[model samples]
Target: MNSDRAAANDVDVDLGRLFGSLRRHWLGMLLFALISAALVFLLAAAATPKFRAETRVLIEQRETVFTRPQGEEAAVPAALDAEAIASQAEIMASAPILTKVARDFDLASLDEFDTSEPSFVEQFLTIIGMKADPIAVTPEEAVLASFREKLEIYRVENARVIVISFSSEDPRLAAAIPNAIADAYLENQRDARQQSNADATEWLEPEIADLRERVREVEERVARYRAESDLLIGQNNTVLATQQLSEISSELSRARAARAAAEADAQAARRALNGGGSLDTLPDVLESGLVERLRERQVDLQAQIADLSTTLLGNHPRIRALQSQLSDLDAQIGSEIRKIITGLETRAETARQREEDLTAEVNRLKAESARADEEQVELRALEREAAAQRELLESYLTRYREASARRDRDLLPVDARIFSRAIVPQEAYFPKVLPLTIAAFVAALLVGAIVLLLRELFSGRAMRPAYAHGETEAPSAASAKTGTAKPAAASPELPPAPRPLDMEPAAQVPTTPAGLTALDIEKAADRLVANGVTRALFISPEGDEAAAAAVLVAREIADTGLRVLLLDLTSTGAASRPMLETSSYAGITNILAAEAQFADIIHADLYSDCHVIPIGTADPARALSGIDRLPLIMNSLTTAYEIVLVECGVTDAAGIERLADDNTQIFVSLIDPEDEAIEETAEALKEEGFGSPVLVSPVGHEPETVPPGRTVA
Candidate 1:
């Protein structure tokens, strides 16, 4: 912090010295300043001015807070600070605010949105190097979020009065935005309140009634399923299902009888065919009781055989005798069984009747179960359809009632009145003319003052004096009486210069070191070289690089026939650098600084003409900022050759003026074509003299005459 103060003090001293320089050479500074002021004023006039328009607004709190949904909070809110509210008003003009405006204005649809297709406005913005970006929105927010950025709302100092303003190319648009913003905000509030009411009605009664019907219908369906399936109130139906068991038992008895009869028939036939004494026929095969009796007898015989076998085997003496007796008994039993079957037809008939009855009973039970299932399905279908119709009727009735109730209570809940409508803008809110102009002027002035001050301090010169050097010294009394000039409006900045008595004057002084004198080709070249012109970038303002070109030609003579290089830098693709002479390490400034050898960058011509470099594609603004590379390039190039010719066809004051420094010898300049071309150029030369520079005229093409009518055209 102390260092800063000291630096500030040093700056003050430097400023003092600068003022002293200006005091001694006030004539030069004044002349330059006058010319500058005139040029600025003329530019201000000639320039397609941005006329501004503004609309003002006042935002008052609404009667009630707006809610988006029932039982929820307000969707729209108003801030308390009056000035901040004004800012909100200003936001009405921002992109987030104006996206709707843009949609209203068809801004996005403009050809500018398409890089290949440009509209008039889009093309204009492109030429001016400007673009618009999309705005961001916040969560749960439905309007312009960056309202403050666009809207300029301000409360008069410590007061409730708010000023809402905006800017646009069209004054009508600027005026409209503020009113639109306010209207939008109010409309938003009204919508929220209305939506809340509607939502409340929608959620409150109808939804619950519909849910009740849904639950009732779904519940009834479940209840009917249990009843139809005979699953009464959590009771199992498995006990009633047991009737199926008796039916299966009856069928089993019939099957057993049929199997027994087939075996008895087979035994009888075998006995009849094997024995010499044969039965007349296989008798009463249909009589199943006879077959069953044979099976029983066989069972008993097997049991008796088992008892005998337990005692002795047939192969054994005792067992053999028993086995012979059993064989004879078996042969006789087949014939006996056949005779029993013929005589016992009634038993066989009884057995057949029993089997038939059991079969009939089983079949009847199955048919009854099928009929019951069909009846149950029909009952369930009828019950389900009835429930659906009842529910539908209930829902329609409920909706009708609620809607009728809402109609009965119909009322406008929120009051929305237009506090103000969009009005024609009276002033531009952005690029604020008064404030911006002042700011710009201050900035330009500060830069000018700093530059002037620095030059004065380092060069040790006076600004403007009451007496000239050629004039005889004035008597002390007369000199005192001459008095200082009114101090030139006492600059808003810069400290006062100390009297000559305060500090020792420099040992020597320059004649007109402050600015340019008469201009010529060589003089301009020298100025450019002094300004550190190594690799020149020529941009012709009036589509001609004549003056800068002449300077280049002069530099060529100094090159002594070495392979010199020139590079034309312009959008027109016109190669003007061939007119210059220069020894170069590299034609491209960047390559030269990076120590690129001349042979690499310099292309020798077949005609032995000086090598000319062509301008590569680059954004002009970005390329110009690399100015520090110039010195390094100059140092490298000048050593390889006699001279480095630089021709810069600068037209803008910012460009030429930016080149002003102690290193340069002079500033060669050209004039615009006009009726008073010579006079204007001469006057401009006088102003340049303040900078201690050289101004150049046309090269081989001297001043041309044009009739008065043609001049302005």
Candidate 2:
């Protein structure tokens, strides 16, 4: 077995072959690329270079404290969002603004903006009825159309800035147009604001006049209503009648309190007299100066009487005189106390009289206050109406004044301003000659290489036989039976095999001299199809060269219109390379390693209808970790395909057992029937209870060359 053959079979891309092909034609490819670049350079050089210039406008609240409306100066203006900026961009490109810019530049007279005649391509398309003819339009429309074509307006991403770009053959015009558009847009904004202000003032004029008249009328109505109802306002803004009633009620309360005091004093004096209590004990009597003096005299008289009685008998002159004086004093004091009692009664009567008068007056005032309250309700309603009118009139006046001031000063500001003006470009943005030429050259080279690859593929020189590496000459039937052979002379073509005398069917396996059955590629495929075998395992013990038998058998079965899949289980995809034309497909190993799925690994054979899974790029060691899944994967493949062919290269009976099932048919693929490995692998399969393995030979049926147009006999 040649290890190099495994490596050769495993390669997906032959870089050496690719480089060699390029090396053989590098001069021609380079020359073609250079010619393409030269053509692009010349075209770029001769082309009318158009210069592009852009003007940037910043959308923001441009109003300052002095210029802004009253009360707006302190407001934090919301920043323009992206949509607002985009709207501004649209406005900048509006027809009116563009028209102004065009007129300002007299763009209609400029040759750049003249589009009266159709282009050659357009005329050709129209003539062939591929495109409709353009409708007739005025020169202004034509010029506008041309102007619009060269204009590009967009808001800068994630920003509130708008960019206005224009292109022209004349760099100065290109620079001038965008600036003019920005200026026109600003002027338009100012004009719009001015118009709005003028409309506001015009509307407010009549409104203010009407409100003033209404305020005057309402005020007059309030005054008239107040006078008619006699609802005169007093101190503290209360109605006069209500105030008078309140004052009277307070005076009446005071009068009733004084009357009550007087009555109480008189009653207390009467009670003292009736109870025979001392007159001095009475508060009214004690408060009298006359009673106090009388009491003092009475006390002096009693002392005198007491002194006389101590010196003389009863009815003595001194005692008698003192007693008489004391009696006289008591009479006078009683008389005075009685007089005081009369005065208290008289005061009580006067107080009672006053209380009655106050109560009557209070009753009269209550009636007046109720009437006043009723009148005041209507009065208050009138005043409220007048007040509201006055307030509205004031607001209107203030707004009118502000609008007047603004109109006179022309203080309105546009929301957007030009932050950056367009400048005449030093270099043309179009016709970037050097870069375009280099790109053209690179593209041409790539295209040329692809064309060369296709040519090499169609000519069949890049393909080689799957078993070409380390191939040994197959021995004749007699030599194979004896297990000893000399190299046979090379023949132009393989001779036909002699038919068996019994004329055995193509589906029957022929018995070898050793009593072992062997089938050529076609006979093996026929036997599989006849038996309805869903799984066929090929053990390539003679190494990579013998694996060609598996590829040939799969192709033969596939040619019978059966859905066949060839699974390459070899260390290298020796068997898969001939069928798939590439070994770099993900397969059982990748599926086992969980690196790829069944869909990713399975690929259609390049030269036949058979599907194949290559040995894969995954590590074999990693794949073995999940080797237990091989039986499951085989079961899945068998369900999807009519026949599933597995090429197990140089694997033992234990390896075979892992992939084998009851329906599995084992074939020992052989390039040399006499090879010792074939016999050993067969014996091993038998020992493993896999039954006798059928020998499949590609000896006479192998293609001279593979992939492009090789076929089996």
Candidate 3:
């Protein structure tokens, strides 16, 4: 067991051994790296070097102030988006442009593009029917394929610039091809614009002539219709009759106003005469020259009477004569007013006659205007038709002029221009000898080191046994020398008891000893606690009842104030049933199957401080699917508890081998001390390099009563 613990402690990697392996094999590794770098250098030197050249074309509206159309000088041209730039790149690599470049360069005759004969490997494959004969193609097709392979066109990221690149064995040809492609693409755009202009000119010429004739005919028809209908436009673009009617209407309105004024004057004058009021009180009467003079005379006579009355008596001859004169003057003024009223009456009658004559003339003009309006509708229709034809003709003429100007001046410009011309490359683009050789050298050194390290590890020459503090190999040597094993001393809290295999050394034990020593549950538990065993794997060869020894021993250890866990790996719940509250509790199988976590599966033992995991409700087959995780589970349990007891029912040494580690103890539990299967199992475990199995019996330590809802099986 001490030897096994030393082997387990030595399992970690030793950096010193790895460094020693590298030191011893470094010369060979360096030589291998040198050879790899040399071969890479030679390959780089023998490979054909390719030179690449690039030309850039900027996609934009190329029209300058002078070349741009009228009224568009200040207009912003729509920018070419990413998709448009990509489309321009595709056009740069179009078949026509590529073919033109290929022909101009005579690419088909170049040795790089030669495809007349099949390769030696191809011929061999064809002869053996391993590969079918290749389909034949023309020289042009072969050249195009090779040219396309060498050419690369792509738009610069987030920009309206296209980069055209070509690779070739000849640096001059590489540079020239890209320049030629750019020139061809520009020329193609110009040709397309010119062709469009030419097409427009051809189509518009006849159409313009037809429109001019139609316009002339429509204008003549309008003129003839105007002459026949007598609907000539007069003032304000109105027909002649309509104009005359408007004039007559204006004159009639004035004449009626004059007549109303004259009648109003006559009526006002008559009302004054009848009401005994002075005629001068009326506006028209006051404005009249004769009436104004009469008013002044009356005012003078009143002043004179006022003065004479102040100085003369009424019976005086002189005063009477002056009064008589005043009477005569008043009578003269009255006669003049009567004459004015008669003139006003005559003027009003003359105004009435004039109003009647003007009204009759207006009625005659209205009839003429109505007839002319009817004719004007048809005339207006003819005029509209002529105007539409004339407008269309003008538009056609304008377009024709523009098209003719473009064709004559040859001012078409492409939207793209070559901004960068390709220059002959001075260096090859591929097979950088220095960098590649250095990389290969470094890579090979790493690979060689890795290979040597693997060899050292697999051969186990790098491993050296490790021992814990205050521990040594003296115990193993003493056991070998004495040929008898000493029993582990019991803990201070427990009584010393007989140990199972202390009577004979493990090496001298027979395959089927008839008088092998046996340990009751208490002594076995004390032995494990004393020896500080972290893991105890119980193999029950005598079936379910024998599994109880692992449970009892776990409980005994837990009672000593040491943490202990019993993991049931048995097919039945024999070992766990007495310690757990229920047989249906989740356990190791559930943990392996990932159905339950540790917190859910670990349960308190009913009668002891030990925790117990039952055989579990999960499917055993499913649990075995992840049985490779058993070691990890045991490691975790061992970390949390001082001792982890595993009851492996009816299993052999091989079955429990994965569960054991450096601090593990192996025990064969049985009801009978001399059971044949136990002896065979102990031999099997010994041959498998395990510590001699400790014999433990559960007969006297069985729990008197099982927990409720559980059976011991």
Shift in Å, residue 672, candidate 1? 50
Q: Residues 1-713, candidate 1: write the lDDT tens digits.
A: 22211221121133454466456555655555556655565555554433334344445443343312223344344454755555654554445545665455554333322234435885676567674322222321222322233446555566444455654556665666666665665555456655665776566466657666766676677667646665332124432323463546656576558645755655565565567444434555334464556556656666776787887765676556655655665665665655654544445455566666767766775665665556556655765765766666566566545444544555333333444455665544444344444455555555666776665444222221232334322112111223322222232232322111111223322222123354444444455545544333232443443333433444333332222455443443334333212233234543524534444454332112244443433444555676566555555554443334444553433444433333433333333433243334334544765243344444332322211111000
Weakest 10 consecutive residues, lDDT, candidate 1? 704-713
Relative to the true structure, candidate 3 reaches a TM of: 0.55
lDDT of 2 by residue, 104-165 (tens): 88988887677667899978987898865555567877788789989999988888889999
Summarize candidate 3's per-residue lDDT along 469-490 as a digit string, tens digits: 4543212222222434222221
Query: Over 4 Å off in model 2, which ranges?
Result: 1-24, 64-79, 125-135, 274-276, 284-339, 455-713
Q: Which ranges of candidate 3 are over 4 A from the true structure?
A: 1-21, 70-79, 117-135, 217-231, 239-246, 268-343, 360-388, 450-713
Off by over 4 Å in 1: 1-18, 47-99, 105-164, 207-418, 426-447, 459-713
Instruction: Estimate the lDDT of model 2.
Output: 0.77
Worst 10 residues of 3 by lDDT: 704-713
TM-score of each: 0.30, 0.58, 0.55
Regarding TM-score, does 1 or 2 come out ahead? 2
Using TM-score as the measure, the top candidate is 2
